[model samples]
Target: MRTPHSHNFAGKTRVSVLLACAALLAGCKKEPAAGPVPGGDAQQGLRLVTQYQCGACHTIPGVQGAAGEQAPSLAHIGRLSYIAGGIPNHPANMMQWLRTPHAVKPGTEMPPMGLTEQEARHMAAFLYTLR
Candidate 1:
């Protein structure tokens, strides 16, 4: 004959086990593929990067003459987990950073490139291809 306290303990144990399983599943989730971004054109993005002269600060891979050392090299930006050191490296986040970096992270050295939505998307698509 179990007491009321015993029943409560059993329930709590079940809850704890469920929570642990959920945590484990979440941890096991795979990272997203470094594929092309939807509705974005990598070729157009390359053009935009060239037009904007992003190589002036960032060392982009595909674009020729993109050998600037003032900022970090985007050799494999797609594999990176974070942008601006905090923002998640998702397509939306990357586009936002490219459009208005100051809005995403105040006082960031990356200045806003004044990119429209489509341009940002294209840029993100190209950047993701670096992986």
Candidate 2:
């Protein structure tokens, strides 16, 4: 069962995703960090959020929610709208969003946390299970 409305709806979704990703990529380029470096996993990912000061804005559960920033709470990323350049809400996209939201959606206020690709993927996996 197909309809013109469905096609139009899909188009809008795609457009939104593309715009997000483009914005992200444009904003992703920056100087890498310099340090001894810490471990990276889901636990480390949680720590990384702190290191990157994500809680300063977003209200992720298990992380400090009292930071009182304008960012949205991320208690349930899998069931959200418009992550990863409008890519459907899934684990992969969530991971990509965490790792490189600006890369995925240029001009996003969310900065790159300098997470390794692996760490980002693991964090995304953790985010999906938060629901």
For lDDT, the strongest prediction is: 1
True lDDT of residue 34, candidate 2: 15
Q: What are the per-residue Cα lDDT tens digits for candidate 2 across 73-130?
A: 7776644545534666655566677777876788888777777777776566545444
Give residue 80's error in model 1 in angstroms: 0.4
Q: TM-scores of the models, in the given order? A: 0.74, 0.54
Clashes of 2: 14
| lDDT tens digits, residue span 89-112, model 1 | 989889889998988999999988
